[model samples]
Target: MLEFDFCSTVSSIFSTPFSLGMFTEPLMLLAETAPPEVVAGDLAEPSEESLFSVGGILTLGMLIVLQAVLGFDNLLYISIESKRVEESKQSMVRKWGIGLAIVFRIILLYVVVKVIALLQEPFLNLISHPLEVHLSGHSLIVIGGGAFILWTAIKEIYHLLAVSDLGEEGDKGEKGNSVTKAISLIVTMNLVFSFDSILSAMALTKSLEIMATAVILSGVLMIWLADHVAEFLKKNRMYEVLGLFILFIVGVMLVSEGGHLAKIQLFGYHVEAMQKSTFYFVLAVLIIVDVVQGRYQKKLLARQAKLRLAEQPSA
Candidate 1:
């Protein structure tokens, strides 16, 4: 101790912070606990590798998966919208529509960060007794989106159920000029659908780098998968009806969610924030029953047709 020099003392003082090892302690514990441990050498230092080295890749994968799951409803809407175009152009419209929508979303993502709090403002209220309701920026998007979805679904269902068929058409009718309309509808709805995801991503991380990375990765996944979703519906035929019904339910969900965002209350109860798990559960049961009943009905019709043919005199 009597031999201490100024240089050594300064070095010791500077090294104290590093020796404390605030960051390394967590990594050591994480290495011990994290799966797929390496055993090439002693686990004491973790081979000087970072425990969070792969966090970027892992986060990208997770965001992609989450985006795909959340975008199912958007995909369904896209497919339905694309059908308004001529058969030859439907695929192209879907591809381009989704592409443009992604670009728009990226722009909106940047803009939203500055105005995130604007979406939370309350514009109006409800009756007495502390029951309140108001329209905020977020609510406007959601409610408007829901209303649009509901209108489209109802129109499609009506056309499917009531309209006789596509039938014959004049040349002008055949050139419905519907492709542009389809693209516009899809792009508009895509923007509407982007609100929830963008807002959620903002809440998740403050880093613009992280948010941008996640959004771009998710957009790429949607672009790759949207066409497949459309084609699946095109091939299934019967599932189109099911898809329409699902769209209706999604519309209802969006309206409820928007109302909640707006803080709207009905009577004394808040109908908007009701748990949608129950709605989905009941809908699943209903779909199962509908499928069984449909199969039974088809079988009965087939049996009747067979009996009638058998009862006919031989030709």
Candidate 2:
């Protein structure tokens, strides 16, 4: 039977030799102040104590809410990516993509829990007069994912502008590789978006089961919401532009976060991560502007139609 030592477990979960030593003293102080049973290793077994408790359940709820809040951009990406395939296969792609991603996310959570310190260790360092970057696994993954999303958004927006007939283009869907490609992209980006959420959950508690449960529940919610969002975009084609721009903002947020994580400096200027509050503020403004402009455009067209009717001779 495996023995459970509370102090050691907390220490291992939060820090390794390679990690910054900021947590070591605080953790030691906590261990010193804890009850004799907790500090002297006289506690109940791990299975009994950690699996389901008031604290664990409360942490679980917090994790679920965190996953949902962070997953909004990811959900948007899935909705838009699924639309590229045939109408019949789009739903399958979403279900399969998220299903596979859920399995992989659990796997990723396990792996990250084990080697989180290694992931944060700086593996690539570039120092020059003009550029300076300290790249780690986490930063590289986020930066790469952000760049891909940015490229996809720009390409899709360009296609929207270049196409002569929007309705005709919407009717024609891609065949052959579209379904496979869409699913692959959806799963990949889903993992990218999961990193920060997983790390945040880790900060709350060290229970793998609790975190995994939250992830599964959040993924289930996403699967249910995916189709509705896609259908909405389909019915209101004008909002597609709004959706794509939101995606663009998401990309920017990810890239900035990665740069901040890596402590990147270009031309002697540091890169800072965009705050979540700022991102949401900008998003709300964008949505309000889009809605107001759409309504104003409709009213203008209505007025034009009325004037033209009045100018015509009575029939």
Best by lDDT: 2
Candidate 2 per-residue C-alpha lDDT over 120-226 given as tens digits, one digit per residue, 9 for 90 to 100: 77899999988999999989999999999999899889988998987788898434457788899999999999987876665555567888999999999999999
Q: Write the per-residue lDDT of candidate 1 for residues 217-291, one digit (tens) a residue.
A: 777777777778877876666677788888888888788878877777766677554233444565577679778
**What overall lDDT goes with each candidate model?**
0.65, 0.79
Measured over all alpha carbons after superposition, the RMSD of each candidate to the real structure, in angstroms, is 14.2, 8.6
Report lDDT (Cα) of residue 200, candidate 2.
Answer: 61
Winning candidate number (TM-score): 2
Off by over 4 Å in 1: 1-52, 125-131, 166-177, 274-283
Clash pairs, model 1 backbone: none
